[model samples]
Target: MFFHQDASFEQLSIHRVGNKAQDEFYVLSEQPVPFADDEVLPGLLMQYFMSPFAKVNEVYRFMHPNEDLELNEVYHFTKKFFDGKMDFHSLSEQLAKHLYEVSSHPKIKGGELYVVHLKNVQMEGDSQEAIGIFKSENKETYLKVYPEQGGFQLDYEPEAININKLDKGCIIIKNEEEEGYQVLVVDQTNKSQEAIYWKDEFLKIKIRNDEFNQTGNYLKVVKNFVNEKLEESFEMEKADKIDLLNRSMNYFKEKETFDQEEFEEEVLGNPQAISLFKDYKSNFEDDFDAKFEASFDIADKAVKKMESAYKTVLKLDKNFHIYIHGKREYLEKGYDEEKGRNYYKLYFENES
Candidate 1:
């Protein structure tokens, strides 16, 4: 069973594939049997066939409320009119006959299924041509070619109007294939393609009207982008913390490379006076320069602490040379695109 459009007439389309179209129809119903709490075969078959028919009847009535149907009478009769322990073929023949009689009335032809019996049809004098028998799975039976076959498969059908916009109420079917085609209705018209926009003239609208205001879909997309970036930033921050501590240690070690006595005396004047400095220098010389080495070590640790903090905030690597010889410098940022360990030069330096 498929939902398709007909421009010329109002009709339902049902196609049976291969030998067991009857068998296949019943089996399709078997899937829904558990819901009805019926025995697998008979109960399943009854529910399967009737449910879609009922829905179609309801839709037909809604579309044509003025028309009276013998649908209810047929439904009641068919429910109890089953043959004893009917099989798929038997039930199908019975249902087909019953429907034909009930819908034979002119006014209620809407629900009628016209069976075109073209058994063993062939050209008048062409026995050797032999186009009559259609091959079924197990056996080859005479073909039933109806005049309606020309109309059954359309060669060039008119294209449906394109709607340029899609609203929130619009149904979206992803990866919809050709044979199992699914269409959406953004407005009153059917949307069969991907490019149709609801705002377009194909929707047969003059002024653009929002169908359930689908602008929320775009807003959701923006929200997702922000959330993803936030997550990435959080991860980068974690990686940066380790970088900071490493840089802090490197900074102080670089600072220690400078002469401590000169840094203290010349850079920072000894106000407690030159006598204290002289005594300190003498104490350092006595113990094989222990005081000088210890002072450098302490300076190195302090500089390392500051450098670590910067590295954390800036996301710099440990191998990246950051020097503070009166000025900050960046030696590397880690791997290059090609060579893997290329260094980068500083972009700028302050004149001050």
Candidate 2:
């Protein structure tokens, strides 16, 4: 899931559909859906609204055309509409009706969709669009996300702070099988396009509870930990830190999985530094209340995502990227006796 808190939702408007910009639709369960904990729904619901693209409500089936598509196939399958068999208005109506039916669905009881106008809905200078959201209820799931990033913002969201912006949003609480009350669960959140396929093709992808997703909140903690340790121990120059992060990201690109030993050897070659990293990692997990995998593997598509956050550039009015690919022998950082000045030198094809 995107976050860890099992929080509650307010401003419940049952079957309350807002305008296209702010529509809240819910499908309630006729039966109570039982859950072990309530730590799931907040993250799940928030992640849903975090999507960049608006998911077409439901899968459409063509009648009269006799074109056979699976039921509950929700996506931008507008080709059929282009064929003159169904028009856009018809398609919209069809999906809307299907959502309404789902709002009052009987077989699975009830489910909900919240079209939220995300107040302060920002990703801090990220070009995150084409987002997909998926949720599962009673074995049914679909990708749900808002399909647009109108503008980007660069503010960090605070924790333990209550953000009540439901004036332009909604949430779906599915009461399945409980027959009374049900606890909700926050399942997953991803910012990497590497995992976009899961949202696009198989809307009902089952998440493995065992293997941790590298793109989850834990990875963010790990990144922070890495940054802090590097800053504290190496006291690295900003350029050096960025270079290390870029190199680490390159390692993830070259090798999908991350082994601590390998990371230490490749990214932080100094023995004592690696030891410091170990301590930082230990404290990080404890302090952040997050964990990492034995071998953290990221989808290759996510490599591009790491590029922005892990870029290594020295700004001198323009920009210069310092790419360090092994061979510390080619680099120099020391004071020159003759010049009595601090200096840093890098050797590469451009210089050679």
Candidate 3:
């Protein structure tokens, strides 16, 4: 449902229970006798955690409220998400739907309530920074992030959403176009939240000097070229790999910018790129085992070519910077030990 820009907590309280900033208990006894103790509801869990939830591990405790809950539910839910059947978008929708189902239950009446802040907002720690929207229901609670001024009337009043330090309740909402997502810690009492982070299909690369007419086309070409090289179907000239890279760079300069939509169509329409991309994607494996293989292969080749290219093609200094894309575990935050490098690193020229 579309929320009003100025809707108050009182107006939305019917969908939830509990008062703002106060401990509101949801008595499972209100429901049927055999009601299961589903650990704690996600909405309440967020209040306890007080910090925004990032991933499953960060909020996994909610899957099983009590030891009595079957272990099978947790395992199956986790498998469904990690097994590649669901992505973030689909997961979020699923979570919302699940929450709606429970919220709509007869026993759940007026369970969702919020503590609204009019002007001044305060939290225990100074680091909490009453920053953005925070939300939760029965399944999970998370922070809602939006682009700068993308949506949400931040000027009026912002709420503190740090789940790590939350002692009291606070109403958080972003009433604007293109804004409305929640960050909450979920209690996986039986079902786990959906895993949907693997949906990013493209890794964007900036084209310096605005040389390429269609910005995305350069990416498409590079993507296609990479796939072809990976599958070993298309062979590069006998010349050094750096030479091939230089050729691609030069080709990018020659192509003029065209409409993004048209460029996408053209790139996708190309039978060679299409076939190569499909092959590359089909061959790609997101599991831990496949990630190591793919990343290692790319890194080994990219590093070698970079070393040669730094001295010859983009010649300037020995130091070269490089970036790579991989799964979160493959590429750690700040530093990636698996690759023995940081997310972005500087290599010195001619330095061993």
Candidate 4:
């Protein structure tokens, strides 16, 4: 998990980035924003920038297709700033300019870009300094109510930023500079073409092949194989599919490490099914550009996160929803010729 409980802002620089496609321009601040005197603003700004990253587990690194890390613009500037070769204000300005160049997307909205130098961010067991890059593209109107002359007064603030909603954010940890740093990012508006520019075009980052990623990706491969590929090669009922999913989840939950051969033999007992699953897993790895090790420690967090997706509900013709947890042998599927309908025979001792 990522935490910033003891984190404090070291430097903050705000710049106005405009939509370049609309012929708008950007404005850079002359100096960093000072918050030493104000006590409350710092906490609010910190929440705005850091709160969204509290539960981010997946990590990414700056990557280039040709294996040249220096080619990544964000990585270059951040590395220089971390090495003390460049000042915070200068680095923020350069980053703002780079963002403006990529803001050419027509759907990209102009907003205030905030560059923050944060200290004492804790991730897992290690504490490290991190750089926070945030942008506020959307604004809201808030009504202010105050007492005036013993009477209630109301005023409207036309341009107000809601601290709770952060539009886009990226946290670049100082650790692992040689491996492109441990970067955690958030893009709340990542539903459109414009959102792609923030992480893909601007950051140029790729998923780090850590334990968390390995576990999550492998689980996804198994799920996809069960749901999609399994049907192509075999005739199976929805209940049977759910049983396979339940078995897969149970294997991950009970075991500390994953062994491909052992998993195939136990969870997928059929030799033909195991062979098909291996081919599908290989294609999945190739499509995602990820390699799943033959054996690795299973990440509990990844398993828990993926548990919700591996639901065991079997929906039957919008009428009955059977939740099959385990014991596929106990649940039998058959046809009732007399009633001219299909039915299920569930053998359960307890009604409750």
lDDT of 1 by residue, 1-352 (tens): 1121111111112222211212222111211112233345433322322222221110000011122222333222222322234333333344344433332222221211211111121211221110000101122223333456455532332322112221111111111122111212322222443223222211111211111111211122222322333334344333333333343244334443444455445532435433444444455345321223323223332332233333322323664444332223343334577876645445555655
Number of the candidate with higher TM-score, 2 or 4: 4
Report how far off residue 31 is in candidate 4 (Å).
0.8
Report lDDT (Cα) of residue 263, candidate 2: 73
RMSD, every candidate, angstroms: 30.8, 18.6, 19.5, 1.3
lDDT of 4 by residue, 256-317 (tens): 99998999999999999999988898898887678889999999999999999997998889
| Consecutive 10-residue window with the lowest summed lDDT within model 1 | 128-137
Candidate 4 Cα misplacement greater than 4 A, ranges? none
* Tens-digit lDDT string for candidate 3 (215-269): 3233343544553463375554222333344444433344443333343344344
**Model 2 lDDT tens row, 249-319:** 66776875667777779877889877776777677667643455657665554455445665445543344
Order the candidates by lDDT, highest first — what do you get?
Answer: 4, 2, 3, 1
Candidate 3 — worst ten consecutive residues by lDDT sum?
A: 197-206
Error of 4 at 65 (Å): 1.3
What lDDT is reached at residue 292 by model 4?
A: 86
Q: 271, model 2: CA deviation in Å?
A: 3.4
Worst 10 residues of 2 by lDDT: 175-184
Candidate 4's displacement at residue 44, Å, is 0.4
Question: Candidate 2: lDDT of 245?
Answer: 64
Question: Model 4, residue 329: what's the lDDT?
Answer: 96
Q: Which candidate tops lDDT?
A: 4
